[model samples]
Target: MTTKLDGNCLALDTVSLSRRNKLILDRISCQLYPGEVLGILGANGAGKSTLLNVLSGELPADAGRVLLDGVVIHDMSVGELARRRTVLPQQAGLAFNLAVREVVAMGAYPFPELSARDVASAIKAALQCAEVAHLAERRYPELSGGEQQRVQFARVLVQALIARNPGEARYLLLDEPTASLDPRHQHGLLGAAAMLAKQEQLGVAVVLHDVNLAATYCNRIVLLAAGQLVAQGIPAEVLQSGYLRQTYQLDSQVIAHPQHPERPLVLFA
Candidate 1:
């Protein structure tokens, strides 16, 4: 079961955002509680990635703010934010030549200096978490697409969970995290994220085009259409057949999963 709390939350406050002279997000506002997995759902060009950028502090909000426990997201220093949140953007490219172990250990780069032992421990932990421990010694660019994705995810998992002191806020934002992976790897990545959210109570937000996976794993769903929030609530509420049909302009049916009621099965109309 997920814990519900009003405090220790992350929120976007009336944020009006755009990119490259094009307006994308318009007056958006929402709150994410600890241990809650908020999955962002939308069709192509629905401003999902833009919203993630705004929340991740990658791009500045034009009219509002991002808050961590009522503190602005950008107000905190980069190192401080790095210690608190981790974002995994799908299809990340590495222009530089770095070994897999070196890439994974970079997650702990928020601190100035690390003992050799700490670096080794952190890389090992990240590799294990990402299920790429065997690839630790490989060259990052030589890895397969799926392997590289897992490696990047390992980096994210490491940084996000490295500092586990009590009362510290944490976040993981993924844009199409499972798009390139096969079915097995998709489950593996999502399973790892779900474990982090449920066991560690991390605040995770993922932008997923796969509605079924979003319903199956996320604690809450946020639906966007043409850069606007049309729905925000539990999977059952936000993934309603009517909402799906209206938002996506397609016919669909919603049914409960036999194993987990929180998981919704979508069928075409």
Candidate 2:
């Protein structure tokens, strides 16, 4: 990744983290640019989520810095950060049985300036983007796991859209968002993420366990192993057989997707 300073990029500058005497992340450095999807790929316990939490300012980097648009993220106020970025965790808990629209409406809390009509419009647009418009009135708790995940996607989309600042780009951080979805919905969710990066000029960083999904949707890929950055580059540069074997400890074949030659397809043994 390029280290050139840009006011439009979210970056990690040799960031490291530790917990209970264990190093969870070790000097990971990368940049997420506006209008691009950067994918984080790793096996279990590779510290993908820890890296994301640090980027989102949910957890501080013990050694280095996490920057948003040339400003240190930790120095920014919570409201300021919330207005510019939204995170969707691996699992989100809702204590009450809120309707889908109500859950999405919670994203508007950061912007008290929005009128009721404006919030409603934002929610509707988010629902349509997430393909959950028909579920707007449905009870969130009663929906299937996949449906609930899509609803959460809508909520974050609303958060990203309504709080956007002019002359600045927003960001979306998603952790394992496709873990609960079927094959089709997995593509839908990631497709929407890619669309957001391209059409809305939002910087997106997503943690994905599935390498193929990352390759299909991401503009760049970061491979992590044992809390360190194994490789960071375009998918074709990083998803080779050697890197896959080192990261996953498996033999695999990497090939170009016939339909989309720029995208690599992995066949694991």
Candidate 3:
């Protein structure tokens, strides 16, 4: 059976990471609350993925802390962490061919004792949510890149849903989820994530390269430059041309979206 997760918060306090005395993240602090999608935006080498890793607890912060519902994440056991959050990297590879359904079912591995019926139900819900139900029986390797991405997303969703404690918020860290997807699938994937944040109250943080996509889908954005947070706020506040130019070093024009005036549309110069 699917567990109902309660809305909660994940917070980072002055998180920093370094390698060989070189800073990769510079005391960045942020919070992701339930019922919201937080986008991480930065140019290449700006530490977007590093921040995601820290938030996910895959990489330890050198000089700060990450808290889930006020509990320090670094102190949590592997199983405890798995029950609360899942990370979907840019690429998930499989050397051996597996059916889509089989691959998605892997997400439930954390619950090895679950009944077959329960596992099947969780996988089904995930596939439908990720818009990959039609490909469930297909071979994962045979599917197109976009199809594979959807399948992997379904896996991550299933993992989060099955492992979460009832009434406790879960988290998802997606690193460049739309990188390999076409325009339509890109929107579709992010749309599903947004729905989950609003409906299921999952705390979602996605690393994105597309400014327009982030503006349209994110509740708030954190802009990073050279490992430091430059600006963070609602899309309208942070998508200003000045910030974009400073971080991305690209001249761009920002205009109000004709349809959604509250959101900005970025046009490259």
Top TM-score hit: 2
Cα lDDT of model 3 by residue, 1-269, tens digit: 32222225788888989988889999998888878999999999999999999999989999988888888888899987887888999888777789999999989987888999999999999999999999999999998888888999999999878745557788888999998899999999999999988887788999999999999999999999999999988999999889998889999999999999989999978
Give the runs in model 2 whose Cα sits over 4 Å from its true position.
Answer: none
The TM-score between candidate 1 and the true structure equals 0.92
**TM-score computed on alpha carbons, candidate 3:** 0.94
Return the TM-score for each candidate structure.
0.92, 0.97, 0.94
By lDDT, the best candidate is 2
Checking candidate 1 for backbone clashes, the offending pairs are none
| Candidate order (lDDT) | 2, 3, 1
**Model 3: colliding residue pairs:** 6-167, 6-168
For model 2, residues 7-29, the per-residue Cα lDDT tens digits are 78889999989999999999998
Model 3 spans with C-alpha error above 4 angstroms: 1-7, 163-166
lDDT of 2 at 48: 95
| Clashing pairs counted in every model | 0, 0, 2
Evaluate model 1: give its lDDT: 0.83
Candidate 2 versus the native: TM-score? 0.97
